[model samples]
Target: MLCDNERGVSLGTVGLKVLTSKDAKKVYAGIVAAGLRAKETVLETAEKVQASASDVLAEAQEINEARNEEIFEENK
Candidate 1:
């Protein structure tokens, strides 16, 4: 099931069932489309998280450098 996959469970024993009947093709298509959309959302969110983390790291480095410069100036 999707829950097992989402939770990082091993799916060796899992069985996937997507109706492939002539009348069910549209249903299968909709399911695939929805899954693709969800994947896109997760990717976008991960990118945002990475960008925010990098920004915070850069700010901290800048602050530390400024403090070091101030100390160096005082010692001169």
Candidate 2:
């Protein structure tokens, strides 16, 4: 019996079990699917963070080089 529960494993009666071996397999599958989706989200977030850091580093390097060039010109 299907119930309006998130896990789909709701007991119909006081002595009834909703989960059998097959039901366990489906639950496992759902867990695996959720894990994969979470992993994908983590990977995507990491990529965005890495890219932002790279851009910031590049900008800092450019600013440092400009400062160095100005210092050399002053020394000359």
Candidate 3:
């Protein structure tokens, strides 16, 4: 959409049309709503990934602690 050559019309021409069109306001509103929805989806996915990473780290720490205790007992 940012690139202007495919439609045989320049970006300036399209911008002008969108600005003056009767339903321009509605079109812009829809664009804004779609963008907000996308942003929300991205944030939710990022939170899930962070939670999974934290869980894996906790499991790793437990394994390491168990290994250390085994080594200490073997030495004694």
Q: What is the TM-score of each candidate against the true structure?
A: 0.66, 0.72, 0.71
Looking at model 2, residue 69 earns an lDDT score of: 100
Error of 2 at 64 (Å): 0.5
Candidate 2 local lDDT, 17-70, one digit each (tens): 444467777998999999999999999999999999999999999999999999
> What are the lDDT scores of the predictions, listed in order?
0.82, 0.83, 0.91
Each candidate's clash count: 0, 0, 0
Model 2 global lDDT (CA atoms, 0 to 1): 0.83
Cα RMSD, model 3? 7.2
| Candidate 1 Cα lDDT to native | 0.82
Please name the candidate that would achieve the greatest lDDT relative to the true structure.
3
Encode model 3's per-residue lDDT on 6-59: one tens digit a residue: 565676688888897879988888999999999999999999999999999999
Show where candidate 1 strays beyond 4 Å. Answer: 1-18
Question: Which residue pairs clash within candidate 1?
Answer: none
Instruction: Mark the regions of model 3 whose C-alpha exceeds 4 Å error after superposition.
Output: 1-22
- Compute the lDDT of residue 1 as modeled in candidate 3: 55
Cα error, residue 75 of model 2, in Å, equals 1.0
